[model samples]
Target: MSPAFRLGGLELQRFARARLTRAALVAVVLIPLLYSGLYLWSFWNPQGNIGNIPVALVVLDDGDLGRELADNLIDRQIFAWKETDPADAEKGVQEGTYYGSLTIPADFTANLKSPSKDGPPQPAYLQVHVDQGKSYLFETIAKAVFAEVQATVGKSAISDYLDRIFVSFGKLHDSTLKAARGADQLADGAGDARSGAGRLQDGLGTARQGTAKLSDGLRTAGTGASTLAQGLGSAKKGADDLLSGAYKLHRGAGTLTQGLVTAKDGTSKLAAGAVKLDQGAAKLAAGNAEAFQQVDRFRPVINQLADQAVPFLRSHTGDIRQLAEFVNVAASFLADCLADLPARIQADRVKADKAYKALKTYLDTHPDLDPQLRTLLEAAEKAAKRLAELADWLDALVGEHLADLKQLERDALGVARLARQLANLAPRLAGLIDQARDKFNELDNGLAKLADGAAKLHQGTGEAVKGATKLDAGMTKLVDGASKLDTGLGALVAGANKLDIGLGKLTGGANKLNAGLGQLGQGAGSLDSG
Candidate 1:
């Protein structure tokens, strides 16, 4: 315990001595201070875009457009680009040797001509190498430089390829618009066509029904025509019978006219003969006047003799009685005949007067003919008076048989007049037959015209039915076209929706790029602060 106490005192004394004598603590403080001073001296004076900037241009592929793009970045004064070999270009970017580098694949020109292919595989590409976090001095400077480089290289590719894409897109847009408009138009037109077709179909159905009705009507008309033909046939038969009867009647009328002419000639001859007889009787009476006066004186003398003979013959009768008696008987018989003749003549006169009175009574009762009938009646009455005188004389002279025969002659003359009137009636009936035949012919011609008109109506109905069927077929085709137009319009709307989504994604990508650029600038700031 005594030795440990003595050693602790000595060790305390040595540690105190070493703290004053070591010298290495001063060296650690001064070295750190020197290094901090050197870093602050070189980095604290920050150079903006103008003083000094380092840029790396590593062209990894063989293309003039890539080299030109790097040169273009330099011309804008955004970076100081340095070209490195392609083999080292990517390695240099990763090791922080240069800011970035661009590489172009072969066939870049050919790929620019057309972007899409349906047949073959295509190979054309571009490569850009960049460090994730590099010095802000180079990275910040190269940002606008590399963007310009990208744009210049893209322009160097086949310009027609971009044009083709643009033109095709434009065509697609126009086609899509056309399809939309066409769909609307087709839908409207199809609807109208469908409605029209329905109406036309209904009209065609009605027309078919009407055709059926027309056929029925035609059948009925045919039946009516047949019946009318039968009626006309019967009428022709009846006409034949009537014509035969009329011909017979005409012949009878001709015979009657000839009979009337013969009768009139005989009556005229009889009248002339009666007038000559009357004149001869007048002349004989006038010329025999002296003889007639002598005869009158002789008649008195004869009457005296007859009286004288009557008395003398009665007294001297015995021998002369036989001869005188025969003479007396003959004279008495002659006197009896003379007395009965005068009485018979008186009765004939009375009968003639009664006939005239009856005829006058009949004429007065039937006097529809005025003054003309009166003139004819007066002439007839004078002729009748003469006939009555003649009848009286004849009745006194002729026997009863001859008087009855003369009365029959008057009845026969009346029968001839009645026959003449009947003959005239037959000619009038023949004229009626001619008029009836003409009327029947007109009826037959009118029925023929009606039959022709019905045939024309049937032909017109058939044409109308065929035209309606064609119209219905055309309208159905228009309705089908609308569906194709609607499908095209839907695809156009989908393309426009994709374009909007891409634009939104592009905006988000641009915001992320801005943040990355800020981080690179922060890493570069460490060269001064750290």
Candidate 2:
């Protein structure tokens, strides 16, 4: 026997003596056996559902959007929902009755349309709270499942919108087709009406009779027209004579006008030139006279100005720098004198007063008639009083020094600062000098290269300028040639006009023959009428 089985058998035997122990052992074995049997029964005859999983569903919203969404979840058969208040669902999750709770806020619909970055919409946020210590993994699965459901719902909403838009688009298409057919029908009806109108116009006998009367009038008109044609023929002959004369006169008049315009342009240019020459001569004369006058007048005035300026510059010359230097030196001396004096004087006065009090106390305390001691005591008293007086004098000196020292210290510091400034400026000046040296080197190199490059550029530019000059001359020649061509074309047009006038005479003769034929016909008709 295996050790494990033997051990288990011993454990079973140990408790076999007591009836209750024996029954419990049997129950332990039989419980598994009963469970196996029940499991087999379940396998053979399966139930589609488990007991309603204690799933809490909470909708914080009262709106139709939340209601519809929650109902969809129920319809999907994901779970048997334990409809509960939001707070109670949390409690149930703690109690282990519910696997998890789903909460929807009041603005769930609005959030579906316009959601925050972290929540809802594509990511499909649902507040799913579970007792993580017990059912955290299940809650995670539920979140994933719900996420898929949300995507499906979003797609469904889109499909609904597409369906509605498609339906509307179909109706619009039909309406448009109907309208187009109606317009076609209207066009056909207009064609039919047009055909009817043509027949009506043709069948009107009164209108035809009126047209026949117009034809009779036209026949009468033909007699008068023949006479008019003869008169027009004579007029055309006269016009041709007049036009031929005008052609000759117009050619002479155009030449005269061209000469006149040229003369006027030349006269205008000559007048402008004369005016320019007169103005130049007047200006030259005035300029020379003014120059001479200015030279004579300015000499004395300049000398006087120099004399006056020399005295003025000399007058203030020493005062500015000398006074500033003197003041600066004096200020430095005063500052050195007053450095520690004010603090010393005040302290000394205080000490002297203290000394006086001490000496008086000693004198009052001792009444011994030792003259040396008494004299020594009196001397100390006088010395203390004198020190006090000295202190006052020192204090007065301190006040004077304080005033002078301020200006003096300022001047000394300014001088010292100037020295330091000069020290600071030395390195900057050196840097500037270095920069200048570099710039000079660059300038030399650049100028040498520039001179070489400029030589080449200048040669190229000269060649280009020469080419341009040639092109300009060629353009001028082309313009002159074009002007000559225009003149030739004008002459050709005049010759062509002469031919047209000759042809017009022939046409007039033909017109005369046609008029005579018309007259003969008219006379025949008149004879018939008689």
Choose the strongest candidate by lDDT. Answer: 2
Please, what is the whole-model Cα lDDT of each candidate in the order they appear? 0.46, 0.54
**How good is model 1 by TM-score?**
0.21
Task: State in Å the error of residue 192, model 1.
Answer: 97
Clashing pairs in 1: none
* lDDT by residue (tens digit), candidate 2, 1-530: 99999986785565555464455445544544554454455345222442345678888764566677677777765667778896588557655677656665454454344322221121113455544333324333454445535544554543232211100000001233334455556545555543344344355455556555555555666666656656665665665455445434444444444444455455555555555555555555555545545454554555565556555544554554455566556655655655666787899899998999899888988888499989988998999989989998888877977877667667776775554444444434444544555555555555555555555555555555555555555555554554454455445434544443333333333444455555655655553443
Q: Tell me the TM-score of each prediction against the true structure.
A: 0.21, 0.22
Off by over 4 Å in 2: 1-17, 34-47, 61-64, 75-78, 96-99, 115-124, 129-530
Query: Of the candidates shown, which would achieve the greatest TM-score relative to the real structure?
Result: 2
For candidate 2, what is the TM-score? 0.22
Measured with C-alpha atoms, the lDDT of residue 31 in candidate 1 is 46
Q: What lDDT does model 1 reach?
A: 0.46
| All-Cα superposition RMSD per candidate | 50.2, 48.0
